[model samples]
Target chain A: MTIVSYIFLIIGAMFFLLGGLGVLRMPDTFNRIQAGTKATTLGAFSIVIGVIFGSVENHLDWIPKLIIIIVFIAISSPIGSSTIAKATYRSKNIPDNLVQDDFKKRGENQ
Target chain B: MKYLITFITLLVVYLFLAGFVIEEVILGSFVSAVLTILLANRLNFKVDWHFPLKLIKFIFVYIPVFIWKLILANIDVARRVLSFKIPLNPGIVKVKTNLKGDLGKLTLANSITLTPGTLSIDVEDDCIYVHTIDVKKSSKDQNQKEISGPFEKILGGIFE
Candidate 1:
């Protein structure tokens, strides 16, 4: 159990690192949101699961609290990313050389 | 009915967080009752004969699919970020959904954002504008089926 927990923790840390690197490397706001949100969401979930495993024997009650945390993250993270993406688009920080842009047409008409 | 639902949901959440202690459960029930009275009417949901079926499907089917897609999304992101060229042909394209319910549409948008290379930018009526990190240049356009993939069909069965 200890080994298993450690493995999950390590994996989570690696993903966190990747998310930071992605934020720095991506060209624009939307892409950075994509990398940052997805990677960190998974990373946090992994770390929580690790905590559950690590503490399960002595603290079974922690499981439900951890599950609640996971549920909250699953709900809130995407909403945050979506809001940022919308704000970025509305503020005209859109990237050049987009292959297709249907939003532009809709934005103009509306 | 709305009050009952809200009360029960809140109580359950409280109990889970409080570790089901005797005093905590009592306190939780009290708080939940007050909150339910105040907030019941604000939440919008429908309960019908299909409610149980939808709940089962959401738990058994939809969750697994979403998790699998999440893993794939991370791997895809990792590959792109790690690559030397960071190959990207990003774009925002519209995809249409037939779901009429607010919850259904919201779930669809969130699912798109968390899965694969797609992030939902905005939703307008029946359509969602998605930002894709790697747009297929061949088609020059995106369709609902390609962007949403398997989710729409399952979501339709559950939410609609």
Candidate 2:
């Protein structure tokens, strides 16, 4: 169990690192946001869940709180990202090399 | 009926969040009941209420699979980020959805936003505009296979 928890934590950390890297490497705001949100959300989730497993041997009481956090993340994180994306669009923050602006096509400027 | 469901849901959330103490549960239920009665008309559920057994199935069955995909997505993004000069052809593509209810559309939109390489930008009618990290990867067929195909099946069952 300890080994498994260690693996989860390590992988979670790796994902978080990769997400930060992706943010730095991506060319534009939209791409950066995509990379940053998707990777970090999952990274945070994995890390928390990993910690739950790690705590199971001695700190079993913490498990429900961790699950609650995970559920909160699962519900809230995507909505948060989508709100950011919508804001970026409304602020004319579309990426320069973006192949198409379907919002423009759809005339959904709010 | 809708108000009752809303009250029950709020109570459950309250119990989960408040650590399931008897006092907390009772207080939360009273608070939830009042809130639900006050807000019930705003929910706009015109149809007669039915037991949401399929929705329970969706929560239990579909959510675990969605989480698995999310893990895969992060790994894929990490791989792409770590790779050298893998040309990212980012673009907005429209995907068709068959989900009937407002809740279904909202769930599908949120699902796509969190999944690999796709961010759901807007939904106009039955079409959803999604920004992809690699447009080449999210061709129409792939969109059906990857994005909507997974949840659409169970969501259809639940929301229908």
Candidate 3:
């Protein structure tokens, strides 16, 4: 593997590990979702890019597929995280020390 | 015209991702574009021909700020989780919004949910139902004001 590929692999691994740590260490469901989405998206993209770089055969094919993967991840991760966070919030699992909420006002306005 | 553009964009996106050859891709794109246009027209969704340039720009600007907030919240949450006491004072709060459009409302709601420690549960006409992780620091009502302040400004800049 080339130096760049190795670098990408290392970066990907670090991001994946950070995501795991965030999931384990975050105090609340919302925080965990934030960490999981951001870190995992970066991690997965990095790994895919690394693979594209390291591959000797059909490099073009891999690159396009990687691009597709990145695009899908970017679009979908936030939606999934938002859904989970909403569910958790409705379920009343949030931490007790929160300072402000804008959603409730939205409810009142309706 | 707006529906046509949206349809074309969607079709192109679909074909590009699907990785079809040029001819097949064009055929698929045309079919999907026509379908999208028909559906959108039938649904009575008004297509705003004049683009919200300011709103698009604001979204880009707000992204970095949102990321910074996420990182800070992550650290705070991590610390709390590691502590033996696990300091938490969860509560639900309502926040008022000034965004005038559906897109603006959605942007604000999604942004709030993306932030660590806050979840946007529901969105009413001009209000939002947010569940917060820490409620001991302030009253639920006060929390609503503080929580909505930045988002209101950001979305206001974008939508209004």
User: lDDT for every model?
Assistant: 0.89, 0.81, 0.68
The lDDT of model 2 is: 0.81
Please rank every candidate by lDDT, starting with the best: 1, 2, 3
Interface RMSD for candidate 3 relative to the native interface: 4.4
- In model 2, the runs with Cα more than 4 Å from the true position are A108-110, B33-52, B137-146
Clash totals in order: 0, 0, 28
Q: What is the C-alpha lDDT profile of model 2 across A1-110, one tens digit per residue?
A: 88888888988888889889988998887788888888888888879978988999997767767888987887788888888887888898677777755667776443
In candidate 1, what are the lDDT values of residues B1-160, reduced to their tens digit? 7678778889999898888789998899999999988887778776566777888999998999998998999999999899987888888888888889989999999999989899998989899999988777666334456779689998988987
Cα lDDT for residue A46, candidate 2: 76
Q: Give the Cα-based TM-score of candidate 2 against the true structure.
A: 0.84
Q: Pick the candidate with the highest TM-score.
A: 1
lDDT tens digits by residue: candidate 3, B4-107: 76677677667666665788677887888778867865666566644567746665977677657655555554565557775655666667777889888877
Candidate 3 per-residue lDDT, tens place, A50-77, comes to 8888874555545556777776775577
Off by over 4 Å in 1: A108-110, B41-45, B140-143
Model 3, residue A32: C-alpha shift (Å): 6.1
RMSD of 3: 4.9
TM-score of chain A of each: 0.94, 0.91, 0.88
TM-score of candidate 1 on Cα atoms, chains taken together = 0.94
Leading candidate by lDDT: 1
Better lDDT candidate (1, 3): 1
Distance from true location, Cα of B64 in model 1, Å: 1.0
